[model samples]
Target: MRIVVAVSLFFLTSTVFAQTKKPASKAVAGPGQQVYEQYCLTCHQADGGGVPNLNPPLKQTDWVQGDKTRLINVVLKGLQEPIEINGETFDNVMPAHDFLSDKEISDVLTFIRSSFGNKAEPVSVEEVKKVRAAK
Candidate 1:
């Protein structure tokens, strides 16, 4: 009888411990996110908030959410002229990221468009290719 009770208690404790175990977290970064971290995270910041007077913020801005071609050109050809974003003027020179592959550019741009509280369409690889070809 004592052996039976001990076995029952062991099974119950094992069941309770198994039930209390938490599931492992699955935190995976997408391809676009990886590209953004590698290239754009420095100036744009992890949360897309650029430096006050140096780099422009990517949050809810026309530059990020507006015309697709213009945005593509910004990455492909770079921007030398002063630009306004979120009511602030940023004249810093954004060197061309033309070295990045079309897919990488598309992914990074798509990530930016969808992230930082901006709800815009994804930038396709074909779009990046067209822009690069044109430039």
Candidate 2:
């Protein structure tokens, strides 16, 4: 009867819709990995350790481990003054990465915070956006 036909059509439509549904994309390593590869790798290398007296390694560094806000600021505004990494002084002028998109910045920060023996929480796009908006 009509009910049977309607039920059949509903099931058919549901099946078609289910089949057409797109599979979700795999979870990315997130913004941090993407940004690091694009920008930081040139100096820091893939290992998070920089050349001697050059870029300075981020591993167990106070700048990256001591305070989250300070690290975030460094990424947003760039570091110009000399910085001490693992007791070694690095005076290189860290060019301002302020031009990066919020997502990119966030990803880079997250990568830095977590990689190379660092265990900081991932940086959020919203946090990056907030920092950018502040200045």
Clashes of each: 0, 2
TM-score of each: 0.80, 0.73
Candidates' lDDT values, in order?
0.88, 0.79
lDDT comparing candidate 1 with the true structure: 0.88
The candidate that achieves the highest lDDT relative to the unseen native structure: 1
What 10-residue stretch in candidate 1 is worst by lDDT?
Answer: 20-29
RMSD of 2: 6.9
Which regions of candidate 1 deviate over 4 angstroms? 1-28
Candidate 2 overall Cα lDDT vs. reference? 0.79
lDDT digits (tens) for residues 1-135 of candidate 1: 999999999999998877666332212367788999999899989999999999999999998998999999998888888888878998998989999998999988888898889899999999999988887
Clashing pairs in 1: none
